[model samples]
Target: MTQQIQQAIAKLEETMRSIGVLDFSGEVQLLEWSKSTSRDGPKIKFMMQDDDSVLPFEVATVKKGKMAGQIYHVFAIRVDDLPIKTNESEIIALEPAAKQPNRLAQAMHTDGYFRNSKLWTGMEIAEAYSQLDHKSYVEKLPCCGTKFAKHIACNGDVVGHHVKTSANSGIRIKPPHWYLVPLCHNHHMTWAHGSHAGSATHEDRHDLLLPHAVALTANQMKVKAKKIMGISSLSEITIELLDAFEEEIFGEAGNKYEDFK
Candidate 1:
């Protein structure tokens, strides 16, 4: 494998460890490569989809001038054969709108979520996530992955996470869309809202955050999207990852304390 391909593969391999995906091996196929111009000058981007035709882990490399970096990113909605959110029969896939409150809860509602009440409007629920986000591992649930819309109006509160795409770090070119990574309330409230954690090192907590998956997937989509749109700044795209934790718990948007009580 070429160094570029090796880098992409290596990143994919490490990312799969977090996503709990199967190893990708045998025949690292060349899917697509395109030449484009950004402020950074001439660039080449290659993309691949997980079709089950190949193993799940492979690197995607982006080259700019002489400098290069390997980034691993993921998308919540399963594309083609991706193991999560791709189910056609599921309510999230069939209804198309069951994305926010989370497809997992919808899929499990009949089995007894929301206290078996089923009062959910398919909208996102806050308390349901309290137990999940506290764990050290990054939130892996598709429903809780990330949430954002192009030109999403902000209420100014940190609602979700956005993957990094800086010229030096991940995406040299500004990504064209706003995204919401499903981050833990703790990370959002404690670290983001205030200062870093005490006992655990910042690097240690950072090792546990959402990484290249979302941003890289955005690049893959940009390949196919091929539409002219404004690119988001690196600072704008960087809220997705963090390396701190605190005891004070923040709350999610559109949540009612009375309901949870």
Candidate 2:
């Protein structure tokens, strides 16, 4: 290794020691810096040893500082290959940048929604939520939300039920979907995967509600119209009754069916 690489390794070793990490034997190599599309700023790869495991990491956004005429660099490292300790005590000092706004920090904040608290693996939670029923109530839903819906509908065999906390806390609510309105499996999946997934595709306000326009079919629309007319069946409506009902109920509300059609 060159002098710069040697210096980096020595710094990492010292960092490990300062953070109370033990058994710190590893190899460090200086890699070409590259920007991350999935995260903030530039990154470099670092390899380390961890008790029968070879840990690889992407050190993001290295910041250089000069102290007493000596130059020092701090690296924002992500444990890419495995789950490392993320507790405040274990991580806060090593990654103070985590306290700032960034994608990694946002992901860490929302991780509880995607990952299982007990197993601490994405696969485990994916499997569990995949079997959930899509049309069920939110309170009764298991990890019930758009995220669960995507896991069950597109990628797997399960359906997600919507759920909101009663007091807005804990998993006590049994059927989450009951509280939420029904959404098609596709739209539900999209919303669960990302925040931008369900937002309007175009810049216009009219375009924002486009998904609602195309959501129902002609048959579904007719059924909805029939319900609003308080008619038991579609055949019960006369032209005169339709006109009067349209003026009374639908004229002011606008033609929602027209948008769907």
Candidate 3:
């Protein structure tokens, strides 16, 4: 393995440990380098264990650039011991509306929600959601709660739903849909692959892009709510609710909570 490849493996191992995923070992498989792609760019390929049952993953190295030294990206599925099927049609049906870019920007700018707020970032949100008291948020959402409600339950206040593009190799650039699902502490950890307790590792820290995920989740919730209520136009309702949520969490737009940094 190249030095770059070894470094990637170390980072991946650290991430797995930080997340409490045990005995998860795999090897890096190199792929053909493309001239169209930067020569300095690390090659992309799968990581698999001896069992070969787990879904193989694509691991990319961070060349010196925008994502220098970082594990540029990883696309993998959680290996489930049980049987599971991927329904392309169902996934396709969940595609976010064409207004996604606008919605994403709106979400990013919504003060108390993410960018400017101190109270909630990816880490804080994940910590808060993992608590036992915060289970309802995950159970009530259209995708998560609606789908897996019976398996989990909690009474904590409902934070917004989350949605984002799947970065896993097989599904890259598929539909960038919104998942109108609720999330609590436990679920958040599961979502982050960091449920096991301890400080996050370099990889885990990189994966903790909670603010971005939260913003997207909230936006997805707005879309789902609009669809459910049969509202003619979602812009007004989404903005109104988002404003109210921000006020409730951050006190006021400019107040600027201390926990944000």
RMSD of 1: 20.2
Query: For residues 1-261, could you state the per-residue lDDT of candidate 2 as single tens digits?
Result: 466766776677667644533222333333334666764556555432211122101111123332112122455433223344566323211221222233322332244211222221222233322112213322222222232232334333334323333332365545322123334445455543335644323331123222221121122233333444665343354444444544554243222233212
Q: How close is every model to the real structure, measured as TM-score? A: 0.21, 0.20, 0.22
- Please write out the lDDT profile of model 1 over residues 1-261, one tens digit for every residue: 356766776576557644544323223222333455564444323232222222122222233344244444433222233243455432222222221332322332233322211212111132322212312122332212122111222232334444333421354553222223433454444443435443223442343232333332332222111111122111111111110000111222222222222
In model 2, what is the error at residue 127, expressed in angstroms? 43
Where model 1 places Cα greater than 4 Å from the true spot, the runs are 1-158, 163-180, 191-210, 213-216, 219-261
TM-score: which is higher, 1 or 2?
1
TM-score: model 3 vs. ground truth: 0.22
Model 3 over residues 142-251: C-alpha lDDT tens digits? 22221222244434444443334334113444212222234455444443234444422344323433333343344333333333333423333344444445454445
Q: After superposition, how far is residue 155 of candidate 1 from its true place, in Å?
A: 18
lDDT of each: 0.29, 0.33, 0.36
At residue 79, give the lDDT of candidate 2.
26
Best by lDDT: 3
